[model samples]
Target: MPYVEVLAPQVPNQRKAALAKSVTDGLMTAFGVTADTVTLYFLPISPDDYAHAGEFEPQGAGQRILLKVHAFRRTEAERRAAAIALTRGVCSAYGVPGDDVAVYFLDRDRSEVAHDSKLASD
Candidate 1:
């Protein structure tokens, strides 16, 4: 299972849906998880609240999306492949520069999560 969180500027509902789907599809393909096992949260941050380097501009940050994926442990090779797939999916779905799509993975032990009210360690 994977829990995905996206931080970006405001987006239309349709675009948000596409963003979620794009990420979900990428993770599913790369990690072999089902749709039900993938959870996504899109957080809209004001441009004033976002800054890059020594500047702050709404559109500057708006043009990019930060993706964080939390999931069970995986080999380094798998992690790299998943990052590439995630970046490609975001770029393809949103017409953004590949660099604009940032991906970070937070790997956890199975004991750290649960599913269907059952602990993963169970």
Candidate 2:
């Protein structure tokens, strides 16, 4: 299972839908994973609660989105492709600059994950 977490400011439901589709498609294309196996969670952060460089509201500070991708171990090339796809999707749907987004890949072992009351390794 590949789980993706998107942390950024809140947006309209339509934008969320588009982001979900884009990320899912990107994962499928880059990771060879089925749509059903991909999972995404959106976490909205309030603007007031965010600060950068000790500034409450930094001027020209575009939206900073953090994407945490968790999945079974994969090659560096795969991670790079996925990162590019994800960044493109986020920039397109969220209307944010590419420099404003950050992506982190978390590699896991099948035995480290559990689903439906069973370990993924089983």
Candidate 3:
């Protein structure tokens, strides 16, 4: 299972739907995983709640998205592909520059994950 958490500024529900679909498609292409195995959670942060360089509202600070991907370890190439996909999804959905998006891969083992109260390794 690959769980993706997206942290970004609030947007409309339609944009969220588009982002989810795009990201799921990318994950499938990059890791050869099925759509059912990919889960996405969006955490919207208000502009007032986000600060950069000690500035609550940084001028000219374009939209920034932080993506945390939790999944089993994969090759570096796979990770890179996933990152590209994620960035593309964010930029396309949010209309932000690619440079503003960041993807962080959090590698996990089967034993470290659970589904429906059952351990993945079981």
**What are the models' TM-scores?**
0.84, 0.91, 0.92
Task: Sort the predicted structures by lDDT, highest score first.
Answer: 3, 2, 1
- Candidate 3 TM-score to native: 0.92
- Clashes by residue pair, model 2: none
lDDT of 3 at 93: 93
Question: Tens digits of per-residue lDDT for model 1 on 1-122?
Answer: 79988887776888778877877877777888888888888887766776777677665654568888999987888788889887877776667888788888988898888878888989
Q: Write the per-residue lDDT of candidate 2 for residues 6-29, one digit (tens) a residue.
A: 998888989888889989999998
Better-scoring candidate (TM-score), 1 or 3: 3
lDDT of 1: 0.80
Better of 1 and 3 by lDDT: 3
What range of 10 consecutive residues in model 1 has the weakest lDDT sum?
Answer: 55-64
> lDDT tens digits, residues 10-119, model 3?
88999999999999999999999999999999998776566666666644365568999999999999999999999999999999989889999999999999989998
